[model samples]
Target: MNLPKIVLALGYSGLIPFFIGPVWLGFSPETAPAWLDRAWLSWAALIGAFMAGTFWGFALPAVQGPAGLLGIFISVALVALTGIAVTLEFAHALAGLALVFMLLLLADFWRERTLDTIGGYFRLRSTLTAGVLIAITWRYLMLPAGGA
Candidate 1:
């Protein structure tokens, strides 16, 4: 189905690095460079923060109620966790990022039941999140110290 072009564009735009970073790393040195690792981790943390903020923005327009309050808290926690996660080891950070995205997708899916998002919003979110998770997990395994 045709989803909102803006959402699709923004979503995929955010996803490109997560998708491409892994692919780029795969073709690079067997032992990935320190700079590349730092760069990808930085990008992942930034994107995670941005996604959490987007959810917070959605809560702003929502009616003052339990759902809106919950959304706000979820969004905030997502950022908080991301901040903490980024400071951890690279392997830990990837796993944390994967969890963060899963929680984000779940939060959006749950929020959509009560609040109004663009049509097919959940589908778009799920697809992008799944793609991100896959890329991260794949890269995680590829990391020398990460699980294989």
Candidate 2:
């Protein structure tokens, strides 16, 4: 099924923050605010947590079985990972968030196979996740040689 226009709009708009970090740093790596990387990392973690919650919601109907339970467990773990990511040193935190995003996508792919989910959502997720990953890598590359 097709996603609603609003959902598409909101989903794509969510990518803006992901790009902001790289773009800002690219333009002014030397003069960018000291908190810029941290802010970007924080935003990534927040979005990751939100996505995890959505994963939990998607997995709810399957709660009667192991698949559902596993999904819920994964969701919780993702949130925890994101929380941990925010507390680490900048480079470590960026790695952690990237890992979390990858895991979340993998989980959603699993969910698509094992449970009911909104049609078109996974495709959108795949696209958005790729964009996120690119932004993350771009930002990472821009980090100082010793890391932020």
Winning model by TM-score: 2
3-108, model 1: which lDDT tens digit per residue? 8688789888887777666777778665666587778888888887888887777787773987778778888999998898888888888888888888888888
What are the root-mean-square deviations of the candidates from the true structure over C-alphas?
A: 2.5, 1.1
> lDDT by residue for model 2 over 24-95, one digit each (tens)?
889877787988877888889989999998878988988889999988899999999999988999888888
In TM-score terms, candidate 1 sits at: 0.86
Question: Candidate 2 — worst ten consecutive residues by lDDT sum?
Answer: 28-37
- Model 1: lDDT to the true structure: 0.81
User: Per-residue error at 132 for model 2, in Å?
Assistant: 0.6
Report the CA-based lDDT of candidate 2 relative to the real structure.
0.89
Model 2 spans with C-alpha error above 4 angstroms = none
What lDDT would each prediction earn against the true structure?
0.81, 0.89
